[model samples]
Target: MAAKRILIIDDEADVREIAKVSLEITKNWDVATAASGEEGVTLASTYHPDAILLDVMMPKVDGLATLVKLNENINTCKIPVILLTATIRLATQPAYVEAGAKAVLIKPFDPALLGGQIESVLGW
Candidate 1:
């Protein structure tokens, strides 16, 4: 099977690096990173990644707004998006789910388990 391609959108450079390295080394996935939601949206259309790991909080174009934009575009609407958030409030999970997030991963995550979590969420 072809390696899964994943796009990660996060403002923090460290977070993006961690996720990119973790996914690549652990799963041998093709990974890409975008510093903001707008960039992510643009890359999503062109790259056609199998999935997206989106940060919930950002300075401009937060995750929810980005998700909306992605859903609005026919080219990206079907791609699964998993939210990476520092917030663990139960109330927010459904909101993200309603906004079309495939899953949510809390911040300070274990890099080793990240791939497994994503696979479980995507049912891969």
Candidate 2:
């Protein structure tokens, strides 16, 4: 099978790097990362990744806003997005799903299990 391509969008440099390495090492997937929502959106359109790991908090364009832009764009709407965030109240999961995220993953996740979490979310 062709290696799955994933894009990770996070404001924290360490978060981005950790996720990137975790996916690449554990799943042998092709991973690209962006430090901000704007760059993430642009990459999503052009890179056309199979999935996106999006951080819920960002400076200018937060995850919710970024998800809206992605859903609004023809090129990126179909790619499933999984929200990577610090724990939110469980009640908000449905809200995030309604906003277009496939799943909500808590931050500080175990690096070794990141790909599996994504696979479960995306049904890969």
Candidate 3:
């Protein structure tokens, strides 16, 4: 099978790098990363990744807003998005789901299991 492409959007450089490496090493996915929401949108347009790992708290455009914009675009709307946040409340799950995110990833995730978790959500 062709390697699945994934785009990770995070404000923290370390987080982005870790996620990139984890996905690459564990899943052998085609991974691209952006440090901000704006960059993420641009990368998404150009890369057309199969899935996106988006961070919730970011400058300029937050994850929720970014997710909204992504869903508005025909080219990106179909791509599954898993939102990453430090705080995941039960009350917020419905809102995230309604906003088109496939799943909510609590921060401080297990790097070893991240790829498998994502694949499960994508039903790969």
Residue by residue across 1-124, what tens digits does model 1's lDDT show?
A: 9999999999999999999999999999999999999999999999999999999999979999999999999999999999999976997788899999999999988999999999999999
Models sorted by lDDT, best on top: 1, 2, 3
Please report the candidate that would top lDDT against the real structure: 1
The models' CA-based lDDT, in order, is: 0.96, 0.94, 0.94
**lDDT (tens digit, per residue) of candidate 3 on 7-118:** 9999999999999999999999999999999899888998999999999989899999999999998889999999999988899889889999999998988999999999
Question: TM-scores for all candidates?
Answer: 0.98, 0.97, 0.97
* Candidate 1: regions farther than 4 A off: none
Error of 1 at 103 (Å): 0.8
> All predictions: root-mean-square deviation over Cα?
0.7, 0.8, 0.7
Choose 1 or 2, whichever is better by TM-score: 1
What lDDT score goes with residue 88 in model 3? 82
